[model samples]
Target chain A: MTLTINDFADLRSAEALEAALRAIGAERYHSNHPFHHLLHSGQLDKGQVQAWALNRWYYQSRIPMKDAAFMSRVVDPDLRREWSQRVVDHDGTREGVGGVTKWLRLCTGLGLDEAYVRSEQGILPATKFAVEAYVHYVRERSLLQAVASSLTELFSPTIIKDRVAGMLKHYDFVDEATLGYFQARITQAPRDSDFALAFVKQHARNEEERQQVCEALLFKCDVLWAQLDALHHAYVLEGGIPPGAFEPVREQGRVAA
Target chain B: MTLTINDFADLRSAEALEAALRAIGAERYHSNHPFHHLLHSGQLDKGQVQAWALNRWYYQSRIPMKDAAFMSRVVDPDLRREWSQRVVDHDGTREGVGGVTKWLRLCTGLGLDEAYVRSEQGILPATKFAVEAYVHYVRERSLLQAVASSLTELFSPTIIKDRVAGMLKHYDFVDEATLGYFQARITQAPRDSDFALAFVKQHARNEEERQQVCEALLFKCDVLWAQLDALHHAYVLEGGIPPGAFEPVREQGRVAA
Candidate 1:
């Protein structure tokens, strides 16, 4: 919990680097955010949950694009082959069978229109910015940093588990079919993270490089955390939604703990 | 005040296109945002103002880069020559006197550490995302749409005047010297917007193109509006700052209006 840039003062062992990356998740991942807390505890109503899901769909949809940006910069066939799995996973081998589709299903399961969500016309500007920043980071940063950023996947399985369980138990609107996206992620995240973490630990050969690795994770965490922050401010807190963002039809959606 | 995508049903006269663009500004500009209201009225304390100036420094700093992105894709020498002036204005003819440097001076004037501000280590992720999105918008969109987005400058003179006048009047820590950046922008923004507007008016050759122009401006409006939304949420409202964002040392900064 007390890791810092100074802690990576020397070239760390592979085990040490992995631990540092995990420590980052322990401290900064979106699972620790209030919106997720509300979400997993069933403290949020369907409309509030809908806002989170709708905004989140932007992040989900951008994953493949982000991966593609990363892959385009890479010259190694091995890395490209491994990285392309992510794009295929979300986009799927066939239509209506991928991570993006499942998330869309969750949105519709919450009563949002499919076209509106697909159009992304209602997404918060902050969401677009945050997700696009992730894509750009992958596109533009060092290959080590770009791969290090995906280490968020290391922590995703648990968050997905908590989210699926919480939503199913708390919201009448949520069901297994609707929540399949997270279910799929439980397996998918660990697989992706393993690849990324191994690549990072091996590729990041110096203390300075290790520091960048930590910063990359921290930035990625901020990307995920900020998306939820936008949602929490817009939907959970008194901060009004930004104009042109999604406005839920129903007002009273939170269930008191 | 009521306008919709339907309003661009015909590619009206150039005068009509100008009216609709102005109407978009009337209805959607950041001048209508509450954060500006707070800023213009001196309702924020030095710390809140610091957060605004510091975070806004990201937007201010990105202008030259955005212009350069816009200029990069211009195939016409006339357009490129005209557009490159924006870069010169922000970057200045010589070292240390451009719009970007002035904004940096404002941050230093606000009691934030010059190096820390320059590092952008403490900036809200939302600010980075929003500003970078603007730069990307310029880089990737149609040249006409990219120019149309700059039309937020169309409304900047009034906001800058109100801000300069109000901050000088209300905040003890502020002086005309620190606020000189806004004074410079008053001339700069209008001149840039006029050129952008004329380009949009002439180049948008049909109803669909005009509609795209309107949508681009709306997107630009959302970009400006969303930056304020993040500031208000993080600094003004109860929404806590994201991990690693600039946190003002003194919390009680908002002045009673």
Candidate 2:
């Protein structure tokens, strides 16, 4: 059945809400985007893949910030305690260990400059906009919706698996080590998404609240899908790269010493 | 001269800063984008034009919100009063008027449903993110930088002129009435942009602040360029329409009832 906002106006049981939220993922998640199809099937060249990794670093780096925004408004110590782990997962207890660092390694492995990737100077303007929208959403929305937005993580493990397998099999630049961030996230996303899903199911008691939860999840999916759309557009289609975004350096043969 | 953050960090005169800002527009504004070139040259078919108008409505509709967000943070009565006119220009003093309503007229003139346009359901996801990013930028950044971002208006009159003349000259579906918004903006943007420009000049006194003012203008240009990039990618180049964005209905031959 096609889902509409009106359809969720009547109270839904927790199970029903959960199912609706998952249905949104099944229908709208970034995994379904054509760019991902190209990415997984080795259709994109190294420069194109580097563009994806560089732009995505903007999103990955902001996870801690999004989580921090959520945690600042959250009052419950137990909820805060559980939620703080997401920050740690992304940022790590120390430098060079967390998701962001691993992502940087992936970029460097693909021959991108570490400083350029970190500066976010070369990312597509769309990537910056969509990722920042997520942070602002967490900062400004109701705490329940903030938590609900994180539900995209519920669909991540499968994408991670497919990505890691596909990248390892198809691309020689990427190996298991370069894909460490996904390996870490395969476990972390589920743990975080589980808590968030439970929190949303528990807190979204009324129909209006449930609808908000569903909308939040769908919004998160849009954020993810928009990024890939940008990648495909710039790197794959007409090569209409906006001024000042990353231009991958195609390595020429080394000079004989 | 190549514009760099460091170039402005040395504290240029107001004339130099203004020139740099104008240079950025010459190089980077959406007016310079190939899609706009196609649009003004009337290379895009009616369906393609509909997609442009429909997606652009999201940006036009949010102008008041972005202005309001900027105004809410301004403590000065004079500044707030001057900036408030932007909201008025877009939203108008009454219903069935203003820039947004005029934009809808253009959409309807192209045969799109008004409610569907207003609902923003057909807008590219990238458009929503980029436009909302503008709103959030105004809300979160320093008031001077917020004002600087509006300096794109300095470049608007020429674009508006070209767009109107080109559309009226080349397309039968478009007439002066359908282009009311550009006609209105041709006068309004310069007036609003002049006030903003003066405010930015007066407020951005130091080297770092000048750099920020320039950077803010560049960022705003990116916001505009990215929207057109998305349109060209989705409708023009690869036909990789994201699942739920506007799909224009082709008018087939009349059928016997």
Per-candidate DockQ values are 0.51, 0.54
Quote each prediction's TM-score: 0.93, 0.93
lDDT over C-alpha atoms for residue A115 of model 2:
70
| RMSD over all Cα atoms, model 2 | 3.2
Model 2: how far residue A139 lies from native, Å? 1.3
Q: Return the TM-score for candidate 2, rounded to 2 decimals.
A: 0.93
Off by over 4 Å in 2: A1-11, A250-257, B1-11, B250-257
Over A191-257, each residue of candidate 1 has an lDDT whose tens digit, in order, gives: 9988888898888887788889998999899899889888988888877877666778732121111
User: Tens digit of lDDT per residue, candidate 1, span B156-254?
Assistant: 898888888888888899999998888878888878888888888889888788888998888888888878888888888888787667778732231
Give the C-alpha interface root-mean-square deviation per candidate: 2.6, 2.5
lDDT of each: 0.84, 0.84
Collision count for each candidate, in order: 2, 0
Provide the lowest-lDDT 10-residue window in model 1 chain B.
B248-257
